[model samples]
Target: MVERLRYPGGLRLLLTPNRSLSWRGNVRIWLLLALVSGIIAGGWALAGVWFILPFAGLELMGVAAGIYVTSRNCQRKEVVTIEGDTIHIESGLNRKEHDWILPVRNTRLESFPPNTPFDCHRVRLANRQQQIPLGDFLNNADTDALVHALKARGINILQTEQQPTVGIWF
Candidate 1:
């Protein structure tokens, strides 16, 4: 998911990974699958294959583990806010947060070539000392839109040709 909000003075851009199922929805689907599997396993157990019960438990645990791993980063997000001369970036994944503050006057947008044929190009905000990647999860179209919005807001984009990635800032 990519969201952009433009204000009178600046703009805010938010990037998040797309999740088809919420955590609750995932739980419900898993539960239903477990129930059906348990019922089938119980039938086999009653037929003297008692080892099926433990295997069923293992299957359930595996399912739970898969869900946990996939959903752990579902709430990850990146936020870029450009207000006046300051640019603020906030990113969080798996409950860990990071922030960066840069001056608009000194900041530059850098574009890198795609690392692989299947990978999109990458974009980053950089200065003399530090650099940060942006819009890691956005598609090509959304990245272009974000760059356009940032350019419209008066930020200097150093390169746009064959740039490797997407990002946004005012």
Candidate 2:
């Protein structure tokens, strides 16, 4: 998901992975699954296989953990701001994990042409001093949209016809 906002000082782009289910919706689905599983486990326990109950509980705990992780990942947000001559990038779930502030004139957008027809382009924000990745969590379509938005905003995007086969970007 992309939200573009205009402020007095600059433009801000809020990027998030496309969400089909809200946090509450996820919880509701989990609850339904848990209730059904719990009932089945209770029935098994009552049939004298009591040990199955503990295993069922453990399985539910593991599933809950997985749900929690997914929820946190889905809640992540990446904020990119362009103000005057500076560009700022902040990424994290609820707090900033990556904070990059660079001069807009020196910074350029670099993307690897998809390595395969099914691959999504890997994008990076780079300057003489540092190269930082952007939109690692976005889908292929969203990534393309991000590249287009950057291009429209007059940010330089490096295009190399050769697809990188083996490389490390720092």
Candidate 3:
């Protein structure tokens, strides 16, 4: 389900199939690929029944591996807590922290999506802000809500300048 799993210092947002976020898209794509490939392999291996069984077994294993990896990476829960002058974000079993007690008086929430299909929820510390990547444990909504809550509490979220351009070759 779409539930907010909160911790002492942060929050975790979870969306899962049969719970919150539907896994239809992921399931559909993978199932289609698996079926198509299985059909092709089966047709070719029909001439050799023994080989067909092994090939089918391998195909199923590959599908299972893909599902395991995708579920492990997506639909995560994150915790963001402010203790003293530092903000700690915990996701999965990993922890990431930022000492915001810098000379910069403001933070920036930039909606930039790199290669990820979903919009990235980033909180950039400004004025010589040192960038730290958050764990892949946070969903888009979780990040946005945390930033908004912080802002409501009088935290200044500043606007960023143009992003640095990167060359494709590089």
Q: Which is the leading candidate under TM-score?
A: 2
TM-score of each: 0.80, 0.87, 0.49
44-113 in candidate 3: lDDT tens per residue?
A: 7776654666767787778868776666555444444544444544445223322233321344433443
The C-alpha lDDT values of all candidates are 0.82, 0.85, 0.51
Q: State the lDDT of candidate 1 residue by residue for 81-166, as single tens digits.
A: 89999989999985539999999899988766564567665778899999899887776776777777777867788775653444
Top-lDDT candidate index: 2
What C-alpha root-mean-square deviation, in Å, does candidate 3 show against the real structure? Answer: 6.6
Candidate numbers, best lDDT first, in rank order: 2, 1, 3
- The Cα RMSD in angstroms, rounded to one decimal, for candidate 1 relative to the true structure is 6.2
Q: Candidate 1, TM-score vs. the true structure?
A: 0.80
lDDT score, candidate 2: 0.85
Model 3 lDDT, residue 63, Cα: 83
